[model samples]
Target: MDAKGSKARNKGVVACERVREEQHRYHEQDPQMQRVLEENYDYMVKHLDPVMSQAIEKVLLYQPDQAADFLAQYFRGTLEVKNYHYVEFQRQQYYDRKVRHLLALAMNSAVKDRPDDVRLYFADFFDARTKFY
Candidate 1:
């Protein structure tokens, strides 16, 4: 990477340090401002730092002709994978809740000495896509 681009990349680190310093200075003087700054810092650390550092490092190393489009595609693919996993997690949670609810209903029926209700629940459970037992 050229010197200018390297310096530009390094500026984020410098600005981050400066923000921390300011945060400390204004810790008691302006609590609300401090909170806002701290939240921004945390967000940058969580969301921006890793992906940005890796993307910048890759771009610098490969020096692609269409750097903007390369970065855009990288971010898009990453976001899609993240979304897919998130959806999968939601579905798993829903399935787990449904299974637990059914199991609870079966237990309740058994406690009430209702064999038919218990049998119905077991039948539904067995027909589910996947079974825990």
Candidate 2:
């Protein structure tokens, strides 16, 4: 950006950061926020049990005797997916146009869908985001 554009953007960033800080402070002190946070935590923990059961059921159905292996694989899988954006952004930080272009293409292929395709589609996003890792 030119000098004037850069200055305006910096101001906007600073304003956003200050507003976020204020929100954190308000959440820390507000009783309503505290109740809402606690309720959210309770809801999340309550829902997790059924999802965990279903995941284990699905895994066990695939390989009944491989529960231990499944858990090990699950841990590694979560680790990789958790770090995907970090690694992807780092790749962006260091790579040139061609590398980013290839990354985008590979990403698209990984999640590609057609109307006549047998795989699942979604409302929130149009692509199937199944991980091969």
Cα RMSD for predicted model 1: 24.9
Best by TM-score: 1
Q: Estimate each model's TM-score.
A: 0.35, 0.25
Q: Write the per-residue lDDT of candidate 1 for residues 32-89, one digit (tens) a residue.
A: 8777678756655664455456645543444333333334444444312222112123
Task: Write candidate 2's Cα lDDT for 2-119 as tens digits.
Answer: 9999999999999999999999988778998788678655543564333344534434334322233333344244412232222222333433421333334432442343222212
Each candidate's lDDT (Cα)? 0.47, 0.41
Q: Clashing residue pairs, candidate 1? A: none
Which residue pairs of candidate 2 clash? none
TM-score for model 2? 0.25
What candidate 2 gets wrong by more than 4 Å, as runs, is 1-28, 56-127, 131-133
